[model samples]
Every structure is written in structure tokens, then in C-alpha cells.
Target chain A: MKIGFIGTGKMGYPMAQNLLASGKELFIYNRTKEKADPLAAFGAKILGCPKEVAASSDVVITMLANDEALLEITAGSEGLIHGLHEEGIHLSMSTVSPKVIQEIQSMHAAKNQILVSAPVFGRPDAAARKELWIITAGPLEAVRKCHPIFQALGRGYSNFGEEPARANIVKILGNFLIMTVIEALSESFSLAQRAKILPQDFLSAINQALFRSPLYENYGQLIVKKAFSEPGFTLQLGFKDATMARDLVESYRVPMPYLDVVYWRFLSALNHGKAELDFAAISSEVFDSWEDHPPLK
Target chain B: MKIGFIGTGKMGYPMAQNLLASGKELFIYNRTKEKADPLAAFGAKILGCPKEVAASSDVVITMLANDEALLEITAGSEGLIHGLHEEGIHLSMSTVSPKVIQEIQSMHAAKNQILVSAPVFGRPDAAARKELWIITAGPLEAVRKCHPIFQALGRGYSNFGEEPARANIVKILGNFLIMTVIEALSESFSLAQRAKILPQDFLSAINQALFRSPLYENYGQLIVKKAFSEPGFTLQLGFKDATMARDLVESYRVPMPYLDVVYWRFLSALNHGKAELDFAAISSEVFDSWEDHPPLK
Candidate 1:
């Protein structure tokens, strides 16, 4: 099947490259154009707009930055909706709101086209290595048709059934869980530092006894070393995900007290102009407030 | 060396049995003498009181309910402090506050006896299997003397160096981390339920993609099945640990917003007469609050 990929940013660039490496015939588009230009070296056809990429392929995948970008590229006058043929499929891999994807699915259905929500769980490095875990939802036929595409870019995939928006809710809640972990680590590590316990030693003890997970070990190391200079996932994106979670839960009338704390931490970090740093940098907010408090040793 | 085991409760019973099975000469005591009477079957000597237990053994291990019990048993007129010989060691394994342990340590030092904080991580089942993870801090020589005891009762141990209270701090922080996870799972599972997603499916997906830890999987299963009848770790004890964490961090001026959320969850669960249920029952509070709201789709 002919495939089209859009949004050649940090996560998208590597994902699209993997599609080409898997020997898929690919058409690519990026608003900046320059970002998409590099994929041509890997035998991908560079298109001028989302509509052009849509016209050239049977299945189009959009991995844009946020809700607005996703909506504009998929439904604008020059969007994919204006160019794809009947029975054409649009696989959305963006971390946008569930409501937006549900609305976009209706728009595609009006033209006899399909939209599938398949947000991923991994960073840019995971994307580059084709190890992203994809969570998908849409019509069974549409999802099955895109399996080859999922296989080309991800290590494995979980289908959340046919509503299409269920996948987005799962993705948002998953990100919320991760942020809570980061917040918990920050608070405990800060307390440990104040008590004069070495952060590394504290991490080793707790991880060995309780967690025994790479998620905690990696994030713990990042916070311990204050390694926020390199961005695996930016603080801005983390804030965006947190905002989406807050909005979604509010609409559902579900009380997520833990999300509120991490949401505030992300907002405070963003306001301090640390949006470009890794989201693990949220720990700095915990450590920074301890300037006046000396160790208890 | 002769060993004394105090507080023959759910955890202490199996731990004492392991020491006896390891061929140690065991002296046992409990507030209710009936609890310690059973250990006599395994070649243990049932003692009259904490004082008699301490007087007969070179080292004593206390695993009790709360800080009050720990302080009362160690410092009262007929307490271990009044009878432990000079150079004897007291190994505390209860989940109590660092301040209480430090104060008791000073009292032990004045009497020419040693105190070592050696709190543990595991439920009763783990204790029964000798699979607990012990965290220790005290004088080097005192800790070395307790190695055979640790090996008899635990899978492994991590020493936090001198200052017996440091081990208690690590233990409290570790419990705090576990509670944060319980709260996170509670909120996310609540949201998933309202969104027409099965709790088991949500748990499986997140555990596979993100956590991959038995800690999350076991607790997630408990929360999903609403199986809070059997207490692995009771909600009441969870509140005690949370309260200690709150008091400890406040004393250090470290803000732990996430802990504040879970702390409230534990308190709410306890007030609702859920003190005897598993701590994962904190999820019941989230689901109970949702009775007024209907599920979407």
C-alpha cells in the first residue's frame, strides 16, 4: 500500500524514516518543508502540502504537534480531507485531545473516508529504534488495514476497540500516570537530599526493593544528575499533555488530585522559561525551593 | 548468638519462625502472650516481657504497629532499655518515624547499648517466604552483627550508613512512593471506567507499555477486581506511614504535593471504615465519588 507521513519533527522524523526503511512507498510533508526535505535522501517523495501527500497515497499518517496543528492539517481547505479518495484511511499518531479525534472521525466519515487514532508511548529515541508502543482505536477493518504501517514504525500495538477516541483517552491517562511518577520522585529525592542521604544511594535502595522498573531507574538518574540539557521529551509537550489530561478528566467529572499537582508543576516550570528542557526538569522546581533549607546532618 | 523477637504479629510471626528454622536460639515476646506461644513449637523460648527478652538475648528485633507502641516497648519502666546488657544491639524493624527511632537510639547509647534502624519492604506473604528487603542504618559493627538475622528473614538488604534514623527516613519515603502509585492508579482507573474502558484492559495496557513491575500489576489487579477484603497492607497502616511522611517533609520544608493527595486518600479511606482493607482500596474512594456521574457511552 502507498503511505503518506506528515509532521517531520522530533518524533515524526524518525518514525517516517523507519517507514521508508521498511521498504514502503512513502510521500512526506512538513509545514516547514525543510524538515521534510531530508527524507527525500531515503527515497521518500516530498510533497508540498498535506493534501498533496494525501492525494498520492492510499493511507496517510499525521503526527503533528498539538490539537490545532492536527485539526488544521487534517481538515483545513488545503488539508487531507480535501484530497483523499473514498475508502482512503487517515492514521493519526498525534497526542491530541480525544474530542478532536472523534470530531475529525465524523468529518472523514462524511466523505466515506476513515480516521484511526493511534497515539504512541515512547520518546524520539524509541521512535528512531522502532520500539514505540502504539495504542490504537477505530473501525476493525481500518485498523487491520493499517497494521503494516504500525508494524513499520512500532514494536507492538494495542487496540482499544472501535470508538477511535478511546485510544486518545488511554494515551492521555498514561501520560498523566508518568507525570505523577516524576512528581513523586521529585518530592522523595528532595526530602532525601535534605536528610543528607545521597540521591543515588536512595534511588538504588528504593528501586531495588520496590520499583525494579527501567522507567524509575532512568528518570531517577536524570533527576539525580540534573541532566535536563538534552530533551528526550520537552517540558512544553509535557505541559500540553498535562493540560489535555486535566481538561479530559474535568469533562468526565473524574477527580484526579495527583494530576492537579503535576499540572501545576509543569505550568510553573514552563513559566520559568525552562520549557525547552526535558520534562524530568520538573524536579528542579522541587530542589530550587530548598535554597534556604540546609541539610539536617 | 541468642536472639529476641518482639511483637509476634502478622509480620513478626513468620520472620521469627524463619530465624528459628535457620537454627538460631530464639527468645520471643508479645503484648498478648498467646501470639508468642506458637513459636515455642519451633524451638523458641517464650519470654514474659520485653525486659526479660532483652536480658536473655544479645540482640532484640521489634516489629510493632505504630510509633507509640515502638516507644512504649523500648522505653517504659519494664522496657527493653532497662534490661538490655551493655554492648547489646536493638534492631528495630517497625515502620515508625525517624525522630522516634533517633530519640530511642540516644537512650540506648546512654545505656551503653546500640540501636540500629532496619525497616523492611514486603507484605506478610513475603515475610513468610523470607523474601523481604531490609534497609539498615546504625554503627558499622552493630549492623554487621545483624547480617545473619537479615539473611534469615530477607532476600537482601541496603545499609544507609550511621545514624539509625536515616534507615527510617528511607523506609518512610519508600512507602510514600508506593502510595503515590496507588493514588495514580486509582485516578486513572476511575477515569477509564467513566470512559467505557474496562479497568483490567487499562491496567494490562499501562502495565505492559509503561510500568512492567509486579508492584503495579498486583495493586492494579486488586483495584480492578475491587478485592480489598484481604489486607496485604491495611489502609490504617498506610495512613500511619503517610502521616509520618507528611510530618517528616514538613519538618524539612520540602513540598510533597503528590503525597498530600494520597495522604488525603488514605485518611478518607480510613474514615469511611476501610481501615482493615488493603491500601489499594483507596481506589474505592475514587469510584465511590463517581456514583453521581454516569459513564459516557
Candidate 2:
């Protein structure tokens, strides 16, 4: 099967490489052509636009940044919708809003094509290791055709049935859950520091006792050492994902108060010019917020 | 060493059983005398009051319900502070506020009796199996002397140094973190249900992909099944812990917005007559709040 890949950025670059390693006939495109050029060494054909890539391949996988970038490449004049053949599959792997994905799915349906939402969980390092967890939903036939592709890109995949938006909602909620952990850790660690407790010691005790989750341990260590200069997922992306969650809950008129708190923390992190730092850097906002407290003996 | 075990509730009973199993000379007490009667068959001496239990043993372990009960047993006329010998150690295992523990610590300190905060994590079953995680902070000599007792009650223990309140603060923060997960799961599951996604499927995917923590799996299962009748931890106790977290954050003047959200959820759960239900039943509040939303097709 021929697979066209778009948006060869940090996460996408490694994912696209794994596709080539799996011996699939691959075509690629990127907003910056140089990022796609590296794939040529692995026998991938670099195309000029999303439309051209879609026209040449049986399946096109998009791993874009956010909803805007995803929609631009899917519905733009030089978009995948303009050139993909009938029954072709557009597999979206971006962390995007469910509403937009539903809209895009209907547009694809109108053209006799399929849009499979398969957003993934894992950072770039996990992507490089092909250890990403993919959540997929779409027509069963289309999803079945993409099984080998999913195998090449992820450690495992869970299908949320045939509604494409289900996968996106699950992805958004998963990110929302992760952000909540970051915020919880930040607030508690801030209080711990004020109480003359070492942040590392507090994290050690809680992680060992309650969570036993790498998600908690990784974020806890990042917050403890104040390591924000390097980012697995940036504050900008975190803010985008948080906004997606906010949009989702608002659309359904369901109240998710925890999301509101995390959303504001991400916004505060962005306004303080830490957008390039790791999303876990939001702990800095939490720590800074408690500056007025007198240090304990 | 001779040990006194007070409270004899669900958690205290199993813990006291383990202490007796480890062959320490045990004295047991309970507000309702009948509750301590069963332990007498296991080589435990059923005592009349907290004072009698404390006076008979070298170490007294208190595992009461909340701050009020703990304070009543520690500082009241028939309290451990009055009956314990000059060098006796008071090991507190209840989930109470750091402020109350500090107050009790000072009272014990005046009489040269050591107060060690050693709050534990695990349900009644974990306590019964001697699999609880213990967090301890007190004077070095006192903590070391109680090492065998901690081993009898827990799988492992982490020491937080000489300040007894430090361990209490860590325990509060740990519980606060767990409550945040419950709130996050509740809100997301509510959204997933409204979107026609099965809560079990949503939980299975996220737990396998993101958390991989038993804490998430257990609570997720409880919220999914709406199984609150047999609570591992009651909603009333959950509310008390949430209140303690609120009090801690307020006293330190630190902003913990996430705690504010969980605090209100616990309050709503209690207000709706869910005090006897499992703490995970707070999800019911999330579901009920969204009742006005028209059912999805």
C-alpha cells in the first residue's frame, strides 16, 4: 500500500521514518520542504503539497500541530480533499477537537473517501521507539486496511467504534487528564515547598504510594528540578489541547471545572512567555503564585 | 514491645490483627466496646478506654476517622497525652490535618512523650493484607523504635524526617492528588457518556495508554459501574480530606484551584446524601449536573 505523510515535524518526522522502515511505498509533504527532504534518503518521495501527496497514494496520514493546521491542509485549495481518489483514507493523528474532525469526516464522506481519526499518546521519544498508543475510529473496512500502518507507528491501538469523532474526543480527554495531573502536582508541590518539604521527597512518596505511573513520575521530576527549557510537549501545544478540551465541554454544555483550572494555568504560562518551555513548566506559574508566603523554618 | 491499638474500626481492626499476628503484646480499645471484643480471641487485651490502652503499652497507635475523633482521643481528658509514659511513642495512622497533628505533637512534647505522624495509604483490604504504604515523620529515635510495628502494618514505609506535621502534609497532598484523579475521571466519563462512548471503553483505553496506575483502574471501575454501596473509602471521609486540603492551602495562602473544584464536588456529594457511598461516587454529581443536556442520538 502507498502511504502519503504530511507534517514531518518532531513527532511526525519519526513516525514517518517508521513507515519507511516498514517497507511501505511512501510519499511525503511538509510546509517547510527541507523537513520532508530527509525522508528521501530512506527512499520516500517528497511531494510539493497535500493534494499531490494524496493524489499519489492510497492512504494519507496527517500528524499536524493543531486544529487550524489540520483544517488548512484538509480543506485548503491545495488540500487532500481536492485530490484523493475515491475510497482513499485520510488518517488524522493530531490532537484536535472532535467537532472539527466530525466536520472533516462528513466532507470526506461526501467525496466517497474516508477519514479515520487515530490520535496518538506519547512524546517524540516514544514515537521514535514506536511505543505510541493510538486511539482509532472510523469505518471498520478503512480501519482494517490501516492495521499494518498502525502497527508500524504504535505499540497498540484501541478502536472507539465507527464514529470518527469518538477517537478525537477520547484523545482530547486523555490530554485533559494529563494536564490535570500536571496542575495537581504543581499546586501540591508548591505547598510542599512552602512547608519546608523537599519537592523530590514529596514526589517520591506519592508516586511510590498512590500513582505508580510514569506519567506522574516524569512530570513530577520535571517540576522538581525546574527543568522547562527542554520540552517533550511545549506549553503552546498544551494550551492548544486545553483549549480543545474547553471547546469540547462547552459544546456539550457539560461542566468540567478541573479543565478550567488547567486551561488558565496554560494561559498564564503562555502570557509569561514560557510558551516554548515544556508544558510541565506551568508548575513555575504555581510556584511563582506563592511568592508572598514567608519561608518556613 | 507492648502496643496499644485504638479505634478498632474497619481500617484499625485489620491493622491491629496484623500487629497481633506479628506477636507484639497488644492492648485494644474502641468507643463501642463490642468492636474490640473480637480481638481478645487473637491474644489482644480489650481495654476500657484510650487512656487504659495507652497506659498499658509502650507504643499507642491511633487509627480513628477524622480530625475531630483523633483530637478527642489525643487531647481529651481520657486521652493518650495523659496516660502515656514519659518516653512512650504515639503513632498516628489516621488521615488528619497537619495543623491538628502539630497541635497534638506539641502536647505530647511537653510531657516528653514522642508523637510520630505515620499516616498510611491503602484501603481496608490493603490494611488487612499488610500491604499499606506508610509515610512517617517524627524524632529519629522514636521512628526507629517503631520500625517493626510499621513493618507489621505496611508493605513499606518512607520517612519524612523529624517534623511530625511533614508526614501529615504529604498524606494530605497525596489524598488531594487522588481526589483530583477522581474528579478528572468523573468529568471526562460524563462527557464520554454524553457522546455515546462507553465509560468502560474510555477507561480501559486511557488506563492502558496514559496512567497504567491501579489507582485509576480501581476508581474508573467504580465510577463506571456506579458501584458505591460497598465503599473502600466513604464519601464523608473524602469530604473531610478535601476540607483539610482546603484548610492547608488557605493557611499557606497558596492557590490550589484544582482542590477548590474537588472540594465542591465532595461537598455536593455529601449534600446529596452520598456520605455512605464510595468517594468515587462523586462522579454521580458530575453526571447529575449535566442532566439538562438533551440526550444525544
Ten-residue region with minimum lDDT total, candidate 1 chain A: A288-297
- Model 1 chain B: lowest-lDDT 10 consecutive positions: B288-297
TM-score per model over all chains: 0.95, 0.95
**Candidate 2 Cα RMSD (Å):** 2.2
Clashing residue pairs in candidate 1 are none
- DockQ metric for all predictions: 0.55, 0.57
Residues B1-297 of candidate 1: C-alpha lDDT, one tens digit per residue: 999999999899999999999999999889999988988998999988899999999999999999899999999878999889999999999999998998999999999999999999999999999989999999999999999999999989999999999999999999999988888898998889888898899998888778878888888898889999989788989888999998987788887888888877887888899999988888788888785667453
In model 2 chain B, the worst 10-residue window by lDDT is B288-297
Candidate 2, overall lDDT? 0.91
Instruction: List candidate 2 stretches off by more than 4 Å.
Output: A292-297, B292-297
